[model samples]
Target: MSANAQMVAKYKNNFLKEVQEQVEMGEWVKMCMQCGVCSGSCPTNFHPGWEHPPQEIFMMIRAGKREEVLTSPSMWMCTSCYNCIVRCPRKLPITHIMHGLANYAHRLGMAPKMQPTRHFAKLFWNNCVKTGRVNELKLSMGLYFKDGFGQGIKNGMAMKDVALGLLKAKRLNPFEMLGGHKCKDQNGIHAMLKKARELEEKRKAIKAAA
Candidate 1:
């Protein structure tokens, strides 16, 4: 094969197998006519220092520019408000493509370097898949100490009313917060979480290199 042909083959997007199999909302990518409705409907213009809108990311994916698509800043900024889905001429859920790209970036260890954002996402994902639900108190307290006691105190105060209400409604138990074996399989949960953290660390190292 010619060098150009070989390079093109190497960088081509494998969106077909991915879009067909896992993603439930990606059917419209093929039907996209390059009308800029999605770009116009984006609630806030996050584009800066870029020549094109998010449609370019979709274009790159369609064209098989794997490296460029994965590394683009536009892939990570999706707020998922679904404005583009509502406004799309082809009725494509453009937001889903953004999310699909984000998930792909996360799996590839190439997600953007918003530390707090990344940290919260890691913690949330770990909690959900491992525990089936998030213990927000645990997350908040964890963040508080990581940030500072002042933030903790401020957080506690900000949540004072909510805490009181929860207590009133019997929605929470302080004893549980203090020390409770809420999960029937706490050991299993811990083991799974440990494995998840190790994988996350490995992915971060890989992303650093990528």
Candidate 2:
């Protein structure tokens, strides 16, 4: 069975339990009282807007709408502004929960494939983790070309002035595309990241066994 399928069977399809055991800070999901303050406090809710706000997501988790909750783009909309956390009467770590849900959904391959936030996050993470330093030029290029080659050219044209300004200011380096400067101890950086992943997996396994 696929990893996701095995997880589903292991959890007996109890999504809330799965989240509690799997996601970071997910054990606090039950503290939500269905108050709409979190939704109201969200700036994205007024502008770009999400399908289901924090409270609604919690409700869905309780109701066991695993697929809907996991596949929705709502969690990816979180900007980590912490407005929800600041305003929540329960003092719940709402921001952490939202990010945790997004991370969990991503791990399960259930997040929206084309979600811009998710795409950008992946690009940024890969760009930084590889060398222990962000290649800003490559990161920008990746984002510009995320749509397509034609769109990428258009995007570049639109930002030509800004690019010129950055180049003149010496803040943006064209040669970094060849190979950016990385941490001195590249091997050590990779080892640390690998160890972190191993520790995380061990922690998750322990949680699951509990």
Candidate 3:
């Protein structure tokens, strides 16, 4: 076979089980019409090549192109807006599936290239590993000054509105918000992370075998 043909053949051969290993999410496993509603309704669909659209990802998964599906940064690109879920013809919770893919990828270390996201996840781990809850002001401000901080950075000045409201109500103190606080559910978060890590390790071994 020509090199191009050979490459195509290999790609097809490698897609099946790998895609199934992505873990089914919500009703996304069911049949779907190739309508662009999900993409149209998606609030962040306009985002940079961040997501591959639920239809495309689901199609790839169904086609068994596991590596391609798993490696796509689209999963992490989801803003979790749930617009797709509300507009689905079959009522599949597309957003949930997106997260499921992300978790699976993260577990297998096959997650798409997302240095900033991984760094954010590391921050999450660091905070949870320490006090449980994040130090918002620090995390927020730190993220603001950093490039590629995700859309979350856009909320910088917007939060002053909330801060002012909070100050008026005396519900929160600006200084207090700066310091780190232990999570109210620290133990639960710890337990969940521990369990997730263990399961991921087992899955990694299984994947390596295949």
Q: Relative to the true structure, how large is the alpha-carbon lDDT of every model?
A: 0.66, 0.88, 0.69
Q: Give one clash count per candidate, in the order shown.
A: 1, 0, 1
Report the lDDT of model 1 for residue 171: 83
Q: Put down candidate 3 lDDT per residue, 85-188, tens digits, no spaces.
A: 88988888788778778777787787755456655665665755766666766666656656545645576666779868877999766677665466777788
Per-residue lDDT of model 1, residues 29-96, tens digit only = 77788888888878654556233455766676677776666655565556677888898877877887
- Ten contiguous residues with the weakest lDDT in model 2: 5-14
Candidate 3 overall lDDT versus native: 0.69
Model 2 regions lying over 4 Å from their true place: 1-13, 47-49, 176-179
Model 1 whole-model lDDT (C-alpha atoms): 0.66
RMSD of 3: 5.3
Better of 2 and 3 by lDDT: 2
TM-score of each: 0.58, 0.86, 0.66
lDDT of 2 by residue, 1-210 (tens): 999976564333488898898998888998889888999999897545399999999988887888888888999989999999999999889899999899999998989998998999999899988988888888988999988999999999999999999999998887875675687887898999999999979988998999
Best by lDDT: 2
Locate the minimum summed-lDDT window of 10 residues in model 1. Answer: 16-25
